[model samples]
Target: MLPGRTWTRLLVCLTCGGVACSDDSQGGHARAHYQETDHPVAGTLEPRSTWRWCYVHRRTV
Candidate 1:
């Protein structure tokens, strides 16, 4: 990967013969993958004198 290079080709390079995304941008992917829905952040451990969690995962039980 090149410097300052995002996961553009990385997405399309996905093997397994699947419909990979060739989007070289950083929006839909973030919303689809890194968004706080599927792989949410862990909001359980206490922050270091910050009172804030890093990966704050808010889900309904």
Candidate 2:
């Protein structure tokens, strides 16, 4: 064994916070990254999101 833990164990600790788990990506990092943020603006939406450009580049013709 390493002074602390084996590399695999260390990675597991960093990823799962130590022992027992469901999703490997089920830890503080996951929770912090994928938190439920539910609060849509009442009634105001652009015809389309500028973010669309991220998924599919747009070209003005």
RMSD to the hidden true structure, all candidates: 11.3, 16.3
| TM-score of every candidate | 0.19, 0.15
lDDT of 1 by residue, 27-61 (tens): 43423443434443221122342221222343321
lDDT value, candidate 2, whole model: 0.23
**Which segments of model 2 are wrong by more than 4 Å?**
1-27, 36-61
Q: Please report the candidate that would top lDDT against the real structure.
A: 1
Model 1 score (lDDT): 0.31
Give me candidate 2's TM-score against the actual structure.
Answer: 0.15
User: Would you list the C-alpha lDDT of every candidate in the order shown?
Assistant: 0.31, 0.23
Among all windows of 10 consecutive residues in model 2, the one with the lowest summed lDDT is: 52-61
lDDT of residue 28 for candidate 1: 31
lDDT of 2 by residue, 1-59 (tens): 32542221112122223322212223422222223322111111234433111101222
